[model samples]
Target: MVEVRHHYATVRGHRVFYREAGAREAPTLVLLHGYPSSSRMFRHLIPALADRFHVIAPDHLGFGNSDVPSVDAFPYTFDSLTDITEALLAQLDVTRYAVYVQDYGAPIGWRLALRTPDAITAVITQNGNAYEDGFVPEFWKPVWAYCENPGPQTEPAVRAALSLDAIRWQYLHGVDRPELVDPDTWAADHHEVSRPGNDLVQLALFRDYASNPPLYPQVHAYFRERQVPLLAVWGAGDEIFGPDGARAFARDLPDAEIHLVPGGGHFLLESHLDTVAGYVRGFLTAAASPA
Candidate 1:
């Protein structure tokens, strides 16, 4: 069995926590986690892939075990977050690697690829949205409203949904096998997000998320221009990033492999870990084959 090890690196004068497994000589696989979660989300996936790949999963600056600086010191924009993550990867001497992005991880991964084109070997997106068609307004209207007016008046509705109940809902919603869902998943998330000043950090990211959709054109152009290897594995039951978002990848890169996991939800990894792991392992193997 592969052993997962925990370590920390100083990026931009802040301590960032990460999980590492496998030998250094193996191809690197960097896992970027989603909202309300961290490298902790990839705990099982890391060990699953560690036998054949060098897996590294890091918690974004404010999320997970990383140091949560005051908003005054660290601006909570995606750019800033990615900059810190990029610095962390560079500190660890990761020259080339594949990125597995989910939820907020999409923006971070895309930015990493854009910043260092030659560094990214492949892209694996799980329920990570990067298109206009996938940004349905029904679920995002409240988010948009909060973005438009960032204050207490507009925050209650958003706050209500982000409570422990909502965090639990995020994990269990649309999941076919509720028994497979772990209560600790949301419990840990609630503990992290409910930290004294963490709400401000989350809200900042929520507002900054609006900046991502406008860049979809650039992201699409990069996919077409670079002809980068792309694999999209999405949960069909996901409310935020639906099947449409999963299929949109094929439009940009006709050769892109698209898999819509039925009976899976946004937090598919929670319930469908082995299934997604199988897909990832096979995809990486095929991607390494010579044309």
Candidate 2:
């Protein structure tokens, strides 16, 4: 049986929670989660890949079991989050690894890739977008408005999006088999967001999201220059980030492996664990093989 262990590390004066699995000598695979979720999201996936990989899934500072410092205490930008993640990896003595990114994790992963391009072996993106084409304008309209101008008028919509009801909708809306999705996912997320100051933290991140799109060109340039292996297994039905985002990877890395799972929504792993695990196992194996 694969053993998955949970632990915490104090990086840069904040408690960071992470889940670890697999043999220490094995290839490392870092799993980065999306918004309103934490390392808890990958509970099942760690064991599935642990036999062949040394898996590490971290809950970003404010999201999971990690320390939720006040917005004034922490910048709450993707750069700050990446800085903490990088420091955590350094403290853990992890040097090289593949990254599995989704949603919010995408920007963090990209920043890591840009910082140390040589250390990244491969990238597996599940609805983690970095292209303009990836934006679903209808779903992002309010977010864009808020990003452009943060005030009472736009803040209300953004705040509502963080509500438990909105969070629940995100999990079930495009999912074909909502019955299969575990209720605990959103419930736990709501509990975290319900924290006294967590809402402001989320809103800060939402406003900071405006900083990501402008870096897409640089990300694409990195892709073309490095030719790093990439696999994009996206939930085609994702309302927030459509399949086009998955397809956009091909434009830069022509050799990228792209798969759009029909009927899969934003949180694909909740309903299609087996399929994603299989893809990850096969791709990471081939990616680590001698060329």
Candidate 3:
């Protein structure tokens, strides 16, 4: 793993943590991880692509070792996080790049696409969603309910979401079996959450996400009409955002390729790094053609 480094953008008033891999001049590939999982998710994927492309993986403000202030102080909304990403890209002078987004990053990354259409040359999504059909996870109901009235049960739930055990469970529970991942990864993520006050920010982000699902239609529209080449690499065993969710990306993207790993979960990168890396490389190569 690359040593932790900070990228401070006066534009956003926060110091973000990121690790840049491969050569600085290789075509850029920005890897945006999901909720609660930091840039660390790209540990394996980064080295694989480092030989050919510049790989950047950043911890979203609340997820990893980046700045996580009180929920009252920061705009933990999906929209604001998208803005942070845009600013980071601009700060880094990345003009055209492929973005790998997953889970909660679906909305934030899509918002970035909407805001900066030309800057994103391609997309790589694994277990991320933008389809009306992909909305059936039972875990989301509480989040939606809390967003409608974020008063009584909000604090406790948010606290729950941030617990070390909670984040660990979210990462591990749905796997076909426990050996799908190295125990050290779980230990590290759990340790990250064990830090005080991290969980509330996580739950707060989820609570705010309740209102942002409406952005899907425009994202799907852009994918279809704009012909962005998307590689939807998903694990067939993801109970949270199941295989059909992977098909949903293909539905919106005519030029999309969907790859399914028979025994993977929300954290497919943990188990299917080789296939994910292969698809990303191939997709980036094919997506560079003039549309």
What lDDT tens digits, residue by residue, belong to model 2 across residues 1-291? 888899999999999999999998999999999998998889889999999999999999899899999999999999999999999999999999999999999999999999989889999999999899999999999999999999999999989988889999888878888999999999999999989999999999999999999989999999999999999998888999999999999999999999999879999999899999999999999998899
Q: Give the alpha carbon lDDT tens digit for every residue of 1-291 in model 1.
A: 899999999888999999999998999999999998999999889999999999999999889999999899899999999999899988999999999999999999999988898999889999998887676566788888988897888788777666999888888777888899889999999999999899888888998988898778889989999888889988888887778998999888998988988888898898888889999998888887887
The models' CA-based lDDT, in order, is 0.89, 0.94, 0.76
Better of 2 and 3 by TM-score: 2
What candidate 1 gets wrong by more than 4 Å, as runs, is none
* Candidate 3: stretches off by over 4 Å: 1-11, 153-159, 289-291
Is 1 or 3 the stronger prediction by TM-score? 1
Ranking by lDDT: 2, 1, 3
RMSD of 2: 0.6
* Alpha-carbon lDDT of model 3: 0.76
| Best-fitting candidate, scored by lDDT | 2
What lDDT is obtained when candidate 1 is compared to the true structure? 0.89
lDDT tens digits, residues 86-111, model 3?
Answer: 88888888888888899877787788
After the best TM-score superposition of candidate 1, give how far the Cα of residue 206 lies from its true spot, in angstroms: 0.8
